[model samples]
Target chain A: MAQIRMETNLLGANDMLAAKNRRIFKARGLLVINLMSSPGSGKTTLLEKTIEALRGRIELGVIEGDLYTDQDAMRIENKGVEVVQINTEGTCHLDAGMIEKAWSRLEHLPIQLLFIENVGNLVCPAEFDLGEDIRVVVLSTTEGHDKVLKYPLVFQQAQVVVLNKIDLLPYTDFDLNAFNRDLQLVNPQIRVFQLSGRTGEGLAQWTEWLVEEVGKRVI
Target chain B: MHEMSLIAEMMNMVRESAAHNNITRISRIKLVVGKLTMAMPHSLRFAFHTMARDGLFQGTELLIEEREVAYQCCQCGEKYLPDMPYGQLCPNCGSKASHLLSGRELFVEYYEGDSGKGEENGANTHGN
Candidate 1:
């Protein structure tokens, strides 16, 4: 019997592709954001609000990932932005390879900010790196405050957390203090913003931060 | 749920290595997964059994080693293992300026196989 030794990373192939994508984005000076959330977290609504806020200032594009429908892509397109849709069939997460394919279709568009809206899955999407400049997780007030602790990996991996549906905060039982404490425990460096997509409240801060990020990424 | 895809990737790597080493029948395969990776061992085992049913992987023993989460304080420069997944704060200085030391690892360590020379039941020394 031969004892062969091989130390290999399971996500090596995906990571390599992600690195390549990162290089391409850097060369083009594009600020890419991977937006993730649960199914009912209102990621699409947040994108709409963000586009409305930063419409004339920044040129933005979107790559929407979903299981079957292209509804989110249509919504972004209606906002007068270049949008591409990737159907992962039944896959829970969009891998780096998928991002590469989607980017190829939208690369010709002259856009400064590119948002890759990932599939609605807190668990699986956290594992795949899409070579984005920033990772943002959308958590709504209706999703309960325990989400940050229950799905710690996603929150820990995210650089920013957008607390959407803030207009309905009074109606929900979400504990803001517990949410902040849990977030601090999981990821101390994470920046958080509380906003409402429907009412357009607190959207300025988020959009301002995004514009600043785009400027910083300019090569 | 994603463990199936993770195992699929592992099998791809194992297939390449087996072809390179001329290993026909695999006897044991070892995997190292960190606790923070969120890849459950039981799910991985189930995936291995379902996907690795070919003749080349017949009766292959799958072993998984779980590594605990460890963190290092950026301010104090102290490394320590955490008791919980949410333990990113330093226990010594009570500071949140800390980074992960381990725990997000998912890799294939090694595999023991035969060259199909009727080496079955040779020693049983690798039984763990």
Candidate 2:
């Protein structure tokens, strides 16, 4: 009985820290997005294309979370945007404390849009809150249509779902209508976009929606 | 995996609680995980069993309580749990304005432990 009370108190502490981080982000008037997807789902590719599309419009900064290496961070930096790499040292997801540390390195940058690319895992990353304005999940058609159903938590928690690699839909047996139906079943209100990062087809709608969302936050 | 880290966090919480309460051993642990968390109960149990070894909760039994997703309709101000996945329309008022109220929590609710052993009969009690 007493032990349970104490455990509750401990989680309370962590939740309080999460709330504090959220409050800080809200005060800054910055739009923070926690981007999550499976490995090789074109997360970095989509990000690159987004940067190119919205570069002049939005002042963007990125915080890349990975198990090891600064490869993703380097990729984002090559786009001439401010980026921070947080190597989790084998940890699967980025928690509030890790984001807090990364924020210190990015606090000085004149950033309006902050994107945190979470480690490539569908399950664990959805569990942690990193003080983001939205939680966006990316799914590539090459990964199969069953992804949304298999990992319902990510889709359920996400505010937006980006279906990348649509160019390969003809080569693969990926079903767009079925995928959208499953996504709607899990999260009806979630905004989903179908696009091919390689061909730059169907990306404009997503970027335009993102620009509008950022605009609303900026004003 | 992230389950390992979460188990480590759970162990720390158990240890801190046992120490604070001056309890020696944790007999059982109770945790509530929301369905939306999507944590595999088996995986979490496996992780906890492996990580809890040689710790304060060496022989503790982890009891996990699962909760379903519930939402409150923002328009009609009605609270209800949806059975179908992605059913945004309220059953009563047919309002699409609904917001998630719970089902994302992952926390250790409490633990049970024996305080001390009795002198003669060796029965568990609050103190020796």
Candidate 3:
């Protein structure tokens, strides 16, 4: 081809489509939060707990992004909320275009707060914003304190940081103090919640926070 | 990893630009990537060769230039590259930095190849 001078971003299309998705959610007054983390970071477990606690408090829907299985979507569906599953096959991350397609599928459904559980990857998922009002990342205590420093982008972009699996802290060498210190160095404005999904500890805090966030969207 | 998807998207954009500029074929492609992305160059090259061999321009030489990690220290108003990747503390005054000045870029700077003479498929000019 002719040597042409072109300056185009790799994620330009995804970003534009994400803006459109955000507009649609905003127009419909739906507060959207994107949940991100590495595989097996207790994201779905936290979602299950949140759905159980806030089931009657707010209308909800979940868009689950998985590599091959619809298991996470099934979990949300069983909790009595609208759920949509997006199987990325082998894609490491979820982009805005995929979110737009999933949103279109749930347009007729009654959803006040949308939780988009992004593909389980700390690196790529954080690079692309899926029109989320807030981006929260879940880090389990088993993943250790070095993870925040290792994967700084995802932690830094997080509006809320959920440190899950705190019940197993006695078994692991995860230093919570160092985690908080590094988290502050990375993002001082981040809202941190240390919770255990299995034992039901600190679930009310997230549930209350979710209710308030959804309420803010209405006004 | 996802470099294949990235390459596919990038080539589509290149094809569109090629069509608009009346380029007959591309030989060399130059890209500027940021170190912060942590994308392996070998994987990127493998992705490019696997997909580009049959589509658009075949046997195109890919050149990648990695940008250094650079950022501005929000607290001390000093700018410097940290010793470690994904470092949050500023070495200057030990303050948390904000603005990222470079090293997150993923874009094609330009390409070099022969273009179809505007008067049809006739002449070839030295493209740099």
Q: DockQ: which candidate is best?
A: 1
Error of 3 at A60 (Å): 0.4
Cα lDDT tens digits, model 2, B1-128, are 66777778888777765666666767887888777777667888999888887746777898988888888888888888876653555788877678877777788776777554421322222321
True contacts kept of 1: 0.59
Over B3-106, each residue of candidate 1 has an lDDT whose tens digit, in order, gives 88799999988888877876799989899998888899999999999999897799999999998888899989988886555567788888888888888889
* Per-residue error (Å), model 1, residue B100: 2.0
Model 2 lDDT per residue over A1-219, tens place: 333353353245456666777888888878899999999999999999999999889899999999999998899999999998999889888888888888898888878888999999999887777778899999988899988877878887899999899888889888888887777667778998889888999999988988888877764
Interface RMSD after interface superposition, model 3:
5.3
Tens digit of per-residue lDDT, candidate 3, span A1-219: 345555677778778988999999999889999999988999999999898888677888899999999989988898888988999999898889899999988999878999999998888887786898999999999989898889887887889999999899999999989888888777878999989999999888888998988888884
lDDT to native, each model: 0.89, 0.80, 0.83
**What TM-score should be assigned to candidate 3?**
0.93
Better-scoring candidate (TM-score), 2 or 3: 3
List model 1 lDDT by residue over A1-219, tens digit each.
Answer: 877677789999999999999999999999999999999899999998899889899999999999999999999999998999999898888999999998998888888999999999898889988899899999999999999988889999899999999999999999999999989888888999999999999999999999999999887
TM-score of each: 0.93, 0.84, 0.93
> First chain TM-score in every candidate?
0.97, 0.94, 0.96
lDDT of 2: 0.80
Model 2 DockQ class: acceptable
Q: Which ranges of candidate 3 are over 4 A from the true structure?
A: B116-128
Report the TM-score of candidate 2, chain A only. 0.94
